[model samples]
Target: MSVATAHVDIVAPAVPGAAPGTVVGAAEVLDRSNRRLGRVPLRAEISTPVEIPHEEQCLVHGWSPYLSVQPIVVTGGRTQQALLSARPANGKGSGGEESRRAANGWIRLWGREPDGQWTVRDPSDMATGGATAVSTPMGSPAILQIGGGRRRPVCTLVPEGSLFTLQPTEHRPQGPVEVRPVADSGFTLLESLRLGEWGWATVVERVWWDEPGVRGTPLFDLAVAYLACRRGNLERAGQWRQVAGNRHEDGPAWIDVLAVDAWLARRRGEWRDLASALARLADAGGTPLVAEGLDLLTAELARPPLEPRAPHPGEALRSVLTPYLRASLPSSLTSFTAAHPGVPQPRPPKRARPSESLPFRVERDTSATRIQWRVLSGPPVDSGAYAPVADRTLLPREPGLIISELGELSEWLIVEDEDPMVLWRLSRTLLDEGVATGVSIVPGRNAVAVALPGLQVRPAAALLADLLGQGRVRRLGLSVGGLRQELSVPDAAEAERILAVLLREGHRSSP
Candidate 1:
């Protein structure tokens, strides 16, 4: 029997120099007999509709220009082939050379079996009638349908906050239907789609009760937490789990939940928990995506250590996990690390011996007000040694607090502030004390990343008479679990003087 297929038109706008029409290019889906089923339209502002070509079959794409494997819907014990025909937007409707180059695109195809084998083929080009076909048996794992450029990864299938309606299905007339994809302004469509692709079983359950304007269902919460975990926001992920309650009525099974919890434990350097989690997931049945994640993680754990390249553990995990799943794991890893502004650096491993390396590395909390730190890497084992590995401790600092790294070698004090007066006051504070060697104002973060190169020295309170006035010195305090030292500006008059200095000295300071 021929496999059933659906027509999904993945359309995009003429980004720069393509046709000047409502749609750009599209993917026309067909069954083994070349019969049409249905189509999923793509665009910048709208969503690729959640159209199940057949029961148990789903058409999914990452939060990107590239569509992922289309889970073939099989019934009545039959297997067949599915075909994807790429149709690029025709003619230079109205654009220039630069515009045309901006609009140029390419396409590719991939196939997956129930046993988890995937095969990929690079089509020569994407022209009308240039179709990429795959054989899908009734029980095959997946058949991918993708469309995008070789270089481009991000493509908008749905804008954040868009609305969706489930309508009615034959089996359940009183379906738990409502407007969908949910208004998650905090995350992008690719992000959510990645969650869908990676959390397949979880996503299936999510649609069961997902409705417009609804928030924090167990399934949806787990997906969001998984996204946060992928982004290295372990603390945030934990909080989301709390919001959704650790357990829910129809949430993931205990084993699947253990999979996520164990992954978090691994990030915190808990190897035993990771092994235990993987063991449980292996014994459990029915959660393929979680199993896939576990398999990817297990391989990485078992593989021999590579040469030191200063790659974070998170980065290593991302590299291992991205091939099997379709969401933008690379970008999430990038955005979750210090490579991207505001991405919190994981707390440094605890140190057994003091080193001359930087005393602290800083990252922001969810509110973006306070700074957080883990211990900086321990002293180098040798000049030619691999990356510094901090002491693997069982306990880690809570990332939400204002942790401070004060000690005898606390020569540097980093002050991140936007006010020019604050910067000027801070520079004077560091310079007059002769404690800091350099003061740099980070442009993007609008905060100062100070370098205190001198020996242990604390600025005297009297030095700030001009700024502190008669308010007298309050007790100096360290917060964020001692990651930051707080200096309060007490008097209104003193605060005014600092604010007044901003217009004149703001640009004078290095920014």
Candidate 2:
């Protein structure tokens, strides 16, 4: 009961789910002990001042079934919002626009000001007086934007149930330290919540990225711009096209980017800018996007839409765009394409018994009526066992793959991995209302991949991404069914480094 809430008050829900333009009544908050916490008034903005401990919980309603709070450090850009809401047993929540107001809470954020001191601030406050915020028109519950216009989004929310995603139109913080999260004076938003009158929070380091201008992979933005312009949202289309233009001036993607511009010029009937962006774009001739942009100059939603993972509109366009990327989480929001080429679409684990996919087994202390996960057969993990990874010579594994030494890999890796492809999609349905466990999320090519030891997969949550936000973790949990299976993240910095590796592939902490 030693939570930071101070029991001052309480309230709750997951990513807001109420219909748009429609307001809801008061949402009540209660803890596992059936103790009444507080209430959250509807449509409240961030800055609840609710300090979350390592673990916390609350029950949700409507399409909004539960409230789970975890603070994450993400550099999704200068500004963005994390959506929270209960889905079916599956991570995919109900229909889109169902619960944009699922849960309401101001993410706890820490940033260094010009004065060089790390202090807490609301996510919305991170932006300057004139910064722009962008988001899908019909996305999840998010904090209010500081400055919203045609360019800035008034609602700061993303879709519910996604494999932790990034978009092209969204800001990219790869190489430059100034644009990176927490590296600069700009505050990186951490996850925290306030739904209605109830404020719920958990210890989590959510990762995010952002950008104010239009910049994503060239080809993707061209396609987006073509569709946006045709749909009468020239302002938005121009935004995507601008990103495409910034990406490259002479290439297939660039050619396509310009065709849209030329097409737009014909429509609005103007051109001639500070730089001849049009000249460089049309340099490369007959590109997929260019042809399409010209063809659809006078059409309307002729094709539904295109996403990195979605099925392509035509085989010809597929050549330049490769395969259409399906959104990591399908929802009502418009897709904001980015330039993460090798990243695959997320495929969350299918429903199944834990023993089939897990190296560890579950047991019930019937006497205590408590459930827990334990390693199949192993003494306590040696905390000091993490030494340098024994170097191994590189071997050609396939035409495009090679095996290399585990340079910085920890030596105490999972040795009991019984199955290499086991992925368990934990059920979101909790039988016990008050049970809350601290957990970590990893961004993966496939569905919500939970990181565990010895799993073969690319990193999901970047270990480096966590370094600036909140480092690796501050201890968390996962509730399987209604049973609270507590996983401990040792306080040692080395242990955290190892856990980051394990969670990067998306799994609960190991023994």
Candidate 3:
């Protein structure tokens, strides 16, 4: 049989129930088996109104009740004195006024030496009695010991307001403790679910599932699987989901899990499985999540796979030229083409008949600085010449027949035979003079329309008024398909009135 030995040591209480300013002594006694034996009595001396002074060491006393049973003598060094002072006692109120008041006086002692301050010589150092040996400092007041206890009380003087108070008590060990309101399995599941939503599913599994001595909760594992799927971790999600399904048949309904599975299948390009999964979701009353999955799957299935086509030159040319024409033409033509959708076939130039001869009409404005040319023939024959025209110039004709010309010239010479000489001479004159004067000889209405679609009468009238003054256009004539309208105004005022009439009726100028 082994005899147990008990050992003691000091300790601080773990509980926070002590009153303010209360100081106590604590101890722990252990048996040979290392088990707790019992608490021991410890005496402590607490200074009243415990003061924490700057740059000064304070003295406190601690004792154990077991010390009495197993007597132990503790010894230390010399006594040092610190100066203390007390003020006169105030007589605020007293029924027994005859009682003599203690002297309103003070006490003072020298503070400990700068190097080695006050020290305790013996336990009786704090006894409430006269010192055996002493020589009072000349200017210092006498020191006093007000009380006695198992622990000695040293004599130290203090100011009236600086009296330190002491209250001592014994401490006991607390009983076995436990936390309240243990969490349920569902609560754990919810916590895991929340963490998984925050992209911490793997962390949850490592910390809560695979940890040593950890207990796994079914709902929590399933929740982790669901979050993994949502994060696009399909393989991990499927593994966990399989575990959950195998472990518990009455788990979260398949409908809740099928939507994510379908999405995963689609991502992995498992079209057959994706279709099956989506069908399952739809049969599950097609919840919003399920419906979204089905919609995505449907779109994916409906899309036709890419069938590469060999490149063709004509297609490439059309793609390039189409944008160029649209940009170069006027906004009116561009807008019209956009509004009317088709293959965007170009408008064919008017065709000339083999038997007909179309002549050109040339006229000069009153200033004689501008020239205008028009083709005079019904449609078919009215098709204008495609050859280049010339402007005014000097030419040595046929050795002696010399001709010099100035001012604007019409390059619209109608020839019975296809004569390159006439066309060449005309083109040279037009290029020199017409270009210099910024004049353009337009052949047909189609060319003019293409160049300046905004030249329709209403806009043209506005432009004329802006260029000249208001009502400057006195006469206007336009013909299309042999249907013509001619309007003449006596003055600017009458011209504005007629222009207003035409504008309101949507009868734009026809070329």
Query: What lDDT does the true structure give each of the candidates?
Result: 0.32, 0.26, 0.27
Q: Judging by lDDT, tell me the better candidate of 2 and 3.
A: 3
Ranking by TM-score: 1, 2, 3
lDDT of 2 by residue, 305-354 (tens): 33446442333433322222331112112121222112222232222222
Worst 10 residues of 2 by lDDT: 182-191
For residues 443-507, what per-residue lDDT tens digits would candidate 1 score against the true structure? 22324444444512323233333334544334222112124434466544443343334323433
Which portions of model 2 show Cα errors greater than 4 Å?
1-54, 57-209, 212-232, 239-249, 266-285, 289-511
Write the number of the candidate with greater TM-score, choosing between 1 and 3.
1
User: Which of the two candidates, 2 or 3, achieves a greater TM-score against the reference?
Assistant: 2
After superposition, the stretches of candidate 1 with alpha carbons farther than 4 Å from their true spots are 1-97, 101-111, 119-223, 226-236, 239-259, 267-271, 278-511
Candidate 1: RMSD to truth: 27.2
Rank by lDDT (best first): 1, 3, 2
Q: For model 3, what is the alpha-carbon lDDT of residue 159?
A: 15
